[model samples]
Target: MSVSVDSPFVHKVWNDSELSKMVDGGVQFPMLSDQGGKIGTLYGIYDEEGGVETRGRFIIDPDGIVQGFEVLTPPVGRNVDESVRQVKAFQLVRESEGSEATPSGWQPGKKTLKPGPDLVGNVWKEWSVKDNYDK
Candidate 1:
């Protein structure tokens, strides 16, 4: 889902634009219009003077708790692939019963860390990389 301070009419216009058409089979996600910036302010992304939210992405759990979030300046673009990966990571951690934690630059099929007091301050001994992360 993407939320903006624009009105629904503006949202509709953008959704129908040529750039938006480049989305695979058209946009599959939700685009919410926050008419008065209330939702953006709630998410702490609304710029009062600018009256627009900087690019912000939030991963929320089923219970409506925010699990992970990223905020980017307006000039920067958000990475949809990274956001998808984060959602998967959150789901993985949620199902792991707190026994495992994803390492930095973790990807699917990569090893995960078992967090514990003994693992603290010695994580480098457990995590290793064959090469730099491609992402």
Candidate 2:
């Protein structure tokens, strides 16, 4: 889901005029309206002076907890691929019940670090950057 200060009508126009061209059938998720920046304010992205919200992406867990988030100015576009990757990593961690941790750039089927005393200072031996990048 996406939340922005734009009204529902503006979201429709944006989908019709621009977003639709980039993704088939426009965005697949709901584009929520935050006309008064109320939701943005709660998320700390609301810019009172500009009356606009900075671009932000938040990943909330099933328990209503924010697992991760990213905020950036409008000039820099967000990375959807990276967001998806992070979501996958988070899911994997949750599935493991906190026993495993993903290394940087970790992907599905890649090596994951197990949290324990043995791994405290032996992460270098357990996993390497090449593990995340090697095919």
Taking every candidate in turn, the Cα RMSD to the unseen true structure, in Å, is: 2.2, 1.5
Expressed as tens digits, the lDDT of each residue in 1-135 for candidate 2 is: 988889999999999999999999898989999999999999999989999999888999989999999999889999888999999999999999999999877877788889898888898897776777767
Against the true structure, what is each candidate's TM-score? 0.85, 0.92
Candidate 2 accuracy as TM-score: 0.92
**Least accurate stretch of 10 residues (summed lDDT) in model 1?**
126-135
Candidate 1 C-alpha lDDT tens digits along 1-135: 778877767777777875377775556677788877899898898888988888878889988999988888899898878888888878888889778888888876777889889998998787766532754
The residue pairs in collision within model 2 are none
- Judge candidate 1 against the unseen true structure and give its global Cα lDDT, from 0 to 1: 0.81
Best candidate (score: lDDT): 2
What lDDT does the true structure give each of the candidates?
0.81, 0.90
